[model samples]
Target: MKLYQVRKGQFVFYKNELHKVYSVKPMFRQSVHLYRLKDMEQILTRAADIELYRPKHNDTFIFYGQRYTIDQYKKPEPGDYILITKPAPDLFDHYSLNEIEKVEEVHENSVTTTKDNGVKHHEYVMLVPGKSEASQEIAYYDKELVPEEQRLKDESISYLAEKDVTLQPYVGDIYLDKRNNTKAMVVAVTESEVTFGHGIHVHIAELLDEESFELIYRYSTD
Candidate 1:
């Protein structure tokens, strides 16, 4: 390698174009960085409203102005987005202050409502960081409750469908063979497996397209 002394405002060759090295440290290459932080206004010529983006998680969707992370849809705050994490509205999403309007009359501790009007906006759902071992267990189990495998499959199907690929459904379309094909309808999907019946399940690999499910094959015959 040829060593060259760098001077300020002097353009030098890098990957392609000549980039002037402003800071040359004696050691640590990162210390000799090229790109400098700048105000975003200087970088863009036009102001575009829509963002071409992707979320880091399945339940996350970039919306309005920010990504709203939710397990289900109900109320969305400003800059909040919507999510379809569960097969149906979960217990948490079903509850609102309106349902509790008659709390003084009701003896029950819990009451729920279906949000028909629209979701209110909130910046965030501040969760109490796990305080005790019990809370930790609750958090752990709640994560396990997410059914990540099916969520992953849903994500996969979405991706392949976007690519216009010929994808297949799950194999456990009710542990289906030729005999029980008539009675099969998707019962439920879970993390790591699909449940078509009380005693039926299939892993993600067993499905033709873990992402875009069409059918499911049962794990066992008996």
Candidate 2:
């Protein structure tokens, strides 16, 4: 960890025990001042000697209306299911649940990504799940915060059907492709097919099929 990354009040592992950062003196080589949470014993240590305290294996939390357990804490690889939180949306994105094109780098508190313009955006990295599916077997840390029955009802296909949901895709309307879990905007709509900017062409008939696609955002002229 760099000196800039160390913040007072953050939890860290020092001397094999969880300690809270009490203060930092940048002028000194041993800048990180930590106090043991259990006994309040204070100690000064170098930034490189300590490790950030994060959720490890089996630690569970409610993320994006679903519960997940931390499988491990490591750098992310392609195709791996990781939980990422975007600060702007204040939501978690899981591989199986959300539209994530790719993960570039996973940091202790943030994930960095470079866009087409070469500007980087930092998003919070929550966890890497052993499995992407939400389970009732693992007790969630925030179970009391969000009831399981309510989450099930919200995500249920039957509940969606009851609303008589309809999609009328127009130019610039955004939709999610259920087959690959990708979001695309309608760039062109013809009698038979709807074309997206990324070269995705979907048959107009598929829009009616719930398994095929779902409307994400509607573009209105008004």
Candidate 3:
């Protein structure tokens, strides 16, 4: 796509996967010459095209195209690269590329790893929904902690208080839970607490005064 055609919230093929365009910086000294694109680095990893093999004690499994024997039931993590030498399933062979459905929502969670020197790095898990529980895997990952520039900005509690941010829940209002790096919608709110669409509840004070919480903004898809 042309530089001018790209917009925030649009999707683009980045690093061989779908990345949501978070922000776009354009430089036009002469005529729309250059632009910078920043995107949320983690996306829902596509699982529909890949095959997963879990082995029982001493059981053999085929991966990509190689056969390996396992002594115990082992699970795969986000970063393991499997060599695919096997032929694809019939379902994949007959379908056209345009007929394939892509995963859109990827839930993110973090794991912290510390070095011997006490320095720490973070890795993120990208969960793909809609698959069966037994089949669902950590479809994608952020290998290292996201840089601050890639993170979503949080509005300070002091700033929120100054703005009179109240726990007046309204549909489409987005709230960020810094503790989990998750975003939820304000589905309902009472005088004492705010409830999210995921059925999570937080006290008004915690929602407004806690450093782990932030009021990103109120928005409506409609």
Q: Which candidate has the top score in TM-score?
A: 2
Clashes of each: 17, 0, 5
Q: What TM-score would every model get versus the actual structure?
A: 0.18, 0.28, 0.24
CA lDDT of each candidate?
0.27, 0.50, 0.33
Could you give me the TM-score of model 3 versus the true structure? Answer: 0.24
Look at candidate 2 and give me any clashing residue pairs. none
Ranking by TM-score: 2, 3, 1
Tell me the tens digit of each residue's lDDT in model 3 across 137-209: 1111231344443322211333333444444446678878765568878787654346777655554443532
Q: Which stretches in model 2 have alpha-carbon errors above 4 Å?
A: 1-57, 62-67, 81-148, 151-171, 174-222
Model 2 residue 40 CA deviation (Å) reads 39
Which segments of candidate 1 are over 4 A away from where they belong? Answer: 1-175, 178-183, 209-222
Superposed Cα deviation of residue 22, candidate 2 (Å): 28
CA deviation > 4 Å runs, candidate 3: 1-167, 220-222
Candidate 2 clash figure, as a count: 0
Arrange candidates, best lDDT first.
2, 3, 1
Question: Which number leads on lDDT?
Answer: 2
Question: Quick one: RMSD of model 1?
Answer: 21.6
